[model samples]
Target: MTNGPLTLMQQTSALRQAIRNQEHTGPTSGLATGAMQGNVVILPKEYADEFLMFCHLNPVPCPLIGVSAVGDYRMPMLGEDIDMRTDIPEYYVYRNGEEAERCYDISSLWQDDMVAFVLGCSFSFENALSQVGLTPRNIEEDVNVSMFESSIPTKPAGRFYGNTVVTMRPYTPKDAIRAIQVTTRFPKAHGAPLHFGDPSSIGINDLAIPDFGDPVSVKEGEVPVFWACGVTPQLAIKNAKLPICITHAPGKMLVTDLLDADLAVF
Candidate 1:
């Protein structure tokens, strides 16, 4: 299949199809410009209940957008035809708290007891940021948002427990405040930020080396701004050490049909 110029939403749909057909398998960071994107998790039915509770307990970092019935692969609520097994650009297979393999799709690993989850992603806030002329540095640099595992502890539910992970974008204090106001409208997408300014305060030791995503320049007067990221679930999934787990690869989001406005709250 040929990659061509398409609108954000159209590109997302096409990319999803490409993923399903094994034509395109990479990060979806900037693919669907203004569309709502999501982080995904697939777990066994036995662990679904507790994981759901974990999400409820820590809604900011784990905003639950869609959930599938046990053994179901289709997420009708997210789009006309969103297959959890293949919609995301890439998948990370985990085994006993370890990353086993990264693949384009999960059809070969499907299980009858599996349940899928879709969580809000930071991409939802980009439109708002751009609207106000504070485009994120990650977007400007054309790279994935920088992510780090934070010291902030999450409320545990059963075996699902871990520190929250965050995504960073650098901006001057004045622009940082504007970013907070713009992101506040989409509570499902993390809503504002947990902390800004000092990286050491949040347990991040290095600004140049992120645990995930490429680093962008922090101008002389700019301070790094962070937001609760959907990747938090991946860390939690690792800590859970389930027999098997599946998640969207970092930057490889599940693009949905829902508009950003659909998730905005006043």
Candidate 2:
């Protein structure tokens, strides 16, 4: 399932094809370096409009990247030959707001009334951080980025509503300020952090336990910086209690052909 080391572009294209063929089945956090990765959420047509509005209302935590027509699996807008049903490395299927199964592909569950939405992910900003000499701790640790449920509330749309989920990356106050500026350029990618310093301020009781992803070391003098996370939609979707829903497993993102630089505002 693993290919020999590949160039960034080659790796990304191969990764997508591998996922499609069920070869590389794991999280996509550091894969496809410099590419625009996405958080995936697929819902029935009955809930698509409301979810779309919710994303529009809260663009920071749920920046919209690609939206598919009802029942359509191909997301031509995001990448050439992209198939939403098979492109993601892993997917979580939920029923009645509860996880039902984890699968490599969802083609069998495809419905004529389903629509897929791809929201921008924080991984898009990691490239900029690296270019500026600030590598994310998750990359250094070779693990998923730490994430937590924040007290920050999002605007509700229909039955969809919940507190925001944030991803954490520890940095000294000095490095954190620079990380903020680097991330701000990619508004579509969950732009700049929502908070930093204390985890308790965000309703998180334990730094070791993350609602999603994996925990990394917090070196001395480093503080945990929190950024709006795409996982916010999963919590909102759960609250919505939709009959059925599908999303990318944590750390497993939708790798697209879009370049990271293309997302910068200036």
Q: Using lDDT, give the best candidate's number.
A: 2
TM, every model: 0.94, 0.94
Q: What TM-score would candidate 1 get against the native?
A: 0.94
Cα-based RMSD of the predictions, in order?
2.6, 2.6
Off by over 4 Å in 2: 1-9
Model 1 ranges off by over 4 Å: 1-12
Best by TM-score: 2
Please give, for residues 1-266, the per-residue lDDT of candidate 1 as tens digits. Answer: 44786766777688778878877777766666677889899999999999999999999999999999999999999887898987877889999999999888789899999999999988889878987899999899888889998899999999999999998999999999889899999998999999999999989999899998888899999989989999898888888999999998887788898877888998
Cα lDDT tens digits for candidate 2, 1-266: 44676766777788899989989888777677888999999999999999999999999999999999888998998887899998998999999999999999899999999999999988889878988999999888988889899899999999999999999999999999999999999999988999999889889888899988788999999999999999999999999999999999888889998888888887
Candidate 2: clashing pairs of residues? none
- Give the range of the ten consecutive residues with the poorest summed lDDT in model 2: 1-10
